[model samples]
Target: MKIKNLSLLVAMMGGAPAIALASGYHFGSQSVSAQGTAFASGAEAADASTIFYNPAGMSRLQGTQFSGGLTFVLPNSDYSDKGSTNYLKRPTGGGDGGSFAPDIVVAPSMYLTHQINDQITAGIGMFVPYGASLDYGGDWVGRYGLTKIDLMTININPSISFKLNDHHSFGFGVSAQYMNAELDKASDAVTGLRMGAAAGAFGPASSAITNLINAGAISGAGTIKIKGNDWGYGFNLGYMYTLDENTRFGIAYRSAISQKLRGSANWDFSGVNMTSAVPGRFRVQSTAG
Candidate 1:
């Protein structure tokens, strides 16, 4: 059998709470070797990446081994306004947002495996399992909906595998994942206008607020920002069966994890006080193969 050399990956992360880039924030660039075939044969366990693809396959590796690689990705995307209208039914005025997504990104991964004995193997892997980023110009029509979003995550996995016989092997592993995110957007123009109007109706004492609004200092067009970080844990199990030297099958399952991302959202419009809590609980499900 020929050992496959894994490739480095460069993957794109599209922005927002819904990770639309690839399979729920998964970059799918963990193995260059796998990428060549679009990950169809990951279960074959032809390289050290088995540490992630199917830990049970680690029992098939000989001696100590290590693999490391990086992927660079360039993403291009734009938003065009097709007659978008604001709350007042007036045309939202702005030019089409240029290519607002990041032009480039780098994703890195590493894995190591050791044979503890004839039937047992141990390994560890570090990689980015999920992430996303997006940015829109301040003048974009959708700026009030979303200006920018960023998410970053990392997973550390330690595993062990045991070969029950020549045909079957089983593996189990645990993961420690850390995630951080930030989001910002322009405040709604209509909401700002309503606040200004309310202040003006409050009589002479509200003159300062009305004056600020007219001067554009409190245009209600400021920004709202939210940021948070959290750590979560999950586990994965795998089973592999070898029908022959050239044919094998594997299955893996990773459990879901819930994280309470404690954070705050702040509105920065002049003369307005606004704040809110965010993400009381967020649950992220794992992938299966």
Candidate 2:
């Protein structure tokens, strides 16, 4: 039942069977919490990702310090819609209208932090800040709307923190970013035109088939392929402050990165069979508040 509604929405979007997303499907799970204590000391004392958060905290640690953990994500995204028709024929085979659905998906991450010095601390963390993927049922009424999508991001960050004084400090890091992106969408069905044509201009639908008839409005069906990936480098800078023994604050800014992905999208049909060679850059920015 829901799938039908999904298909309808996809159809409205001028696509195949479903619609899912905010740009590419990659929304790296590298949530703000990982920076955990880096943003708020109150939160940091509880976890280890702090190695990546505010490694400088090591300066405050006594002996050896180590921290590591992983994050798992499950996203629920889908579509639903109604069917379009001309004559009021009770839908044959008492069944539902239409639908579009996405499978459950998960993305993971891990990081470690160990205090190395009293004033200068160092740590390493591997994480995916952005990642997500989705697929539509192939048999959907609007299969040509959106078929598939995938995107991923991985960051290997090694950082160091310095304690300038009891009240404030500074930290810096060299970041290596890896990115992968995929976008796939289908052409229009023009099913409306074909159905309308079959209903009108004369013949019964059963007979319409024999006549090899349908509205000419359905110019044609097309397909598109969009996929790309790129790798780049950047940096993260942070400042930490101790308001008191129980409270502290941290601010960090990650530089922007430009990922160049290369791919192609083509349209197939009668007179206008065309192909478009596609390539573009995906930019990313990180901010902590």
Best by TM-score: 1
Q: What is the lDDT of residue 168 in candidate 2?
A: 82
Candidate 1 worst ten-residue window by lDDT: 6-15
Candidate 1 structure quality by residue, lDDT tens digits, 111-219: 9999999999999999988777777777787776667888888899999999999999999999898888777766553344444445353355356544554555533
Roughly what TM-score does model 1 have, to 2 decimal places? 0.75
lDDT of 2 at 100: 28
Off by over 4 Å in 2: 1-47, 55-58, 61-65, 82-103, 188-222, 264-289
Structural similarity to truth (TM-score) of each candidate: 0.75, 0.58
Clashes of each: 6, 21
